[model samples]
Target: MCDTCGCQLHEHHHHDPKVVEVNQSLLAANVQQAMSNRQHIEKMGAVAINLISSPGSGKTTLLERTIEAMRDTVRIGVIEGDIETERDAERIRAKGVPAVQLTTGGACHLDAPLVHGGLHVLEHFAKGAGYDLIFIENVGNLVCPATFDLGEHIRVVLLSVPEGSDKPAKYPATFKGADLVLLTKVDLLPYFDFSMEEVRKEAGLLKPDLELMALSATSGEGFDAWLSFLDRRLNR
Candidate 1:
């Protein structure tokens, strides 16, 4: 069984010395592949963003809204990672954006090699025109996703209003690795007991310089700042 997620693949067992060595080897391989993937994305004329969050944290919704808001100005593509489903990729395609779905079977997170494959498919779908922005919507899990870098230029972690403010404290490693932390579903704030101040404090403690934004994809509240952030990244 895998120590990290208890899957039958045994890809991440670390209790025994042999397993530890194997894990290390696997991570090293992933790192090398991730570096190559970065170069591949650059060659395709695109910057990739890895989006990480727990299930139901509004990651997909944010992407759909982002595509709707910027599809005209930005040549956006998506690589959707999920345990099992073409559903999210279908959603992105419905928005008139090219999307590649990568199902990890039962794995909790996406590794670099998987994303490397997805990038190729995305590029093929682009038909040599290339892309300005590529979003890798990672499998819906915060813990495992943090350990594997998928060659993204920016890592954004989402916390919805209903997910509570304590998520940062609970998932410190994920937040620490994030370049930006988004508080999604802000329109639900009036109905939920979530605290923006607490989220800011805990997330700030984990990442002192983290760029934080609160936005609602449904209501369009605080959504412009999110778009502006993407614009700035594309311009940079």
Candidate 2:
């Protein structure tokens, strides 16, 4: 059981066959929608990326900076997910990119069905210009978002320095689902007790070959690598 949330994270025996069947059915439906979402994105000539992390992990700031850096060279679209408010989408719009905000109405995560609608809105925003990349910023929770695929080509999880280095081990499931991990707020390293070595070691235990990068979006320190990572994916 998770000490913080009281949620079961490991396998356990369930005698209720109906409950098991229902859960399986729900997940299967989600998978089908996710596959369709992937096809839709491909048809739009774009690759989608899902970003998952806890609140205050600098996901929006990272997107803001990334849009500023890549806007001229890449046709980008954003889908910002939150439990409430269109604030994040407005921020992206301020940067002049097509952004759709999906408010989950108190839900903890954004599911494939929810993102499907957002994708359509984003497509409308493109007006047939087409996009090179689509960024889906999942609701700011590590746990629930990990269960939904959202049809992304890559999944990037963020861990800010202020959040502590122990997060990777503490939230093993989220880290394990990541294709790449970003250690944000690196500029605060000297101020916080966060250890880069500990983060790398623990995350490696979850995913041995997981690509990791440390950057301070505020400072632009190590930011170039992030742009290159996106460029490589877009080119591929």
Candidate 3:
């Protein structure tokens, strides 16, 4: 019975709920765009990587460093996502690599459609220069971003040491969806309360085969593994 007006279930009543059986995931639109985006990325001669993490996880900084590290050996491009501003893309462009920024206005996550547009923009910037790998740095978010697929071959989730180690257990869905979990800002371990063991244990419980690495982008600690991982993915 409808508590507001007490309308009968079978009668022609406004209070009766429609109960439309639209058995569809909230990410349906995103999934469709992802399928198309994957094809688009392949056509552009590159594999894409979607990086997710909470605010201040050093995603942009890491990308800046990554461009310096791999731009010469591997043709790298980037699509930066943010609520507003093209600062990240500007930073990437300074590295002499083509980059495009997709500002979401107020969206918390970067969906596949936005990335699809960004890919085209990047192509325009490059104008047939080509890229071996495209990094779609997602909006700084650990929750809603996990639900949407940007057609990336690998989804990397970053966790800075200052954010602590309890994030995996706190946000299992994000951790489980990750193909690789990068623990950043590890150089600050002595000052922070982060526990490496706990983070790995929780993340492992969620995804038994989840690849993980601990490093600091600032200190250049544990970066070779990340570069190797990227090489393997691109070659594959």
Candidate 4:
């Protein structure tokens, strides 16, 4: 597949090199659509968040808990991204909020243009219950998702305890661009060799001003701080 827009990569017809000397990121098109999508989300009376993490890092589980905790007080909408299947989307819908599944069809990331289509579909599902917050659950990959802009007001990176504290250093590009870092499954801290101090320090080295939150979605550990952070962003 083509790297830029996920279209099929193929040879182009020979053309005069002198006629074009374009300088652009392979993600140029995605960046443009991301800017437009940001404006569109703002116009929809909602704040958007892009969640990224490795597979099995608990992104969907966190969303499920978040919906259960705030659905009555906060109008929430979700866009689930995966290589295939709407099962994640179905889980969100059971909570009675607008949810749309965006199958990447084998892409490793969710870029801006794909999200634009998701927003329209979500609004249709919203019916009369408009959203105050929109969460875009990106395909569970810590690498490629960091390279594409997806028009989110906040970008959160999650690191589960079982994944160890070295993730920030190992995936610097992803953690470096994060607005917040979430350490999930912390209730299992006693069973894991994870070092919170190292995780914080490494993430700080990459993104000095990045906010950090530690929580266990299952046990509700440190959830108040996470909820408060979202509250602040929405009120902003």
TM-score of each: 0.89, 0.89, 0.89, 0.90
- Give candidates' CA RMSD values in order: 8.8, 10.1, 4.8, 7.5
Instruction: Give me the overall lDDT of model 4.
Output: 0.92
lDDT of 2 by residue, 45-151 (tens): 89999999999999999999999999998999999999999999999999999999999999999889999999999999998898999999999997889999999
Q: What's the true lDDT of residue 206 in model 3?
A: 100
Decreasing lDDT order of the candidates:
2, 1, 4, 3
lDDT of 4 by residue, 1-236 (tens): 65445556555343445766788887799999999989988888899999999999999999999999999899999999999999999999998888899999999999999999999998888785567999999999999999988999999999999999999999999999899899999999999999999998998888788889999998999999999899998944
lDDT of 3 by residue, 1-236 (tens): 76556766745456446668898987799889999999888887898999999989999999988889998888888999999998988999999898888999999998888888898988888778777899999999889899889999999999999898999999999999999999998889999887899997999999999999987888999998998899888855
What lDDT does candidate 2 reach at residue 166? 97
Clashes of 1: 0
> How accurate locally is residue 33 in candidate 2, as Cα lDDT from 0 to 100?
95
* lDDT of all predictions: 0.93, 0.94, 0.90, 0.92
- Superposed by TM-score, candidate 3 places the C-alpha of residue 16 at a distance from the truth, in angstroms, of 16
Which runs of model 1 end up more than 4 angstroms from their true locations? Answer: 1-26
User: What's the lDDT for residue 99 in model 1?
Assistant: 96
**Pick by TM-score: which candidate is best?**
4
lDDT of 1 at 54: 96
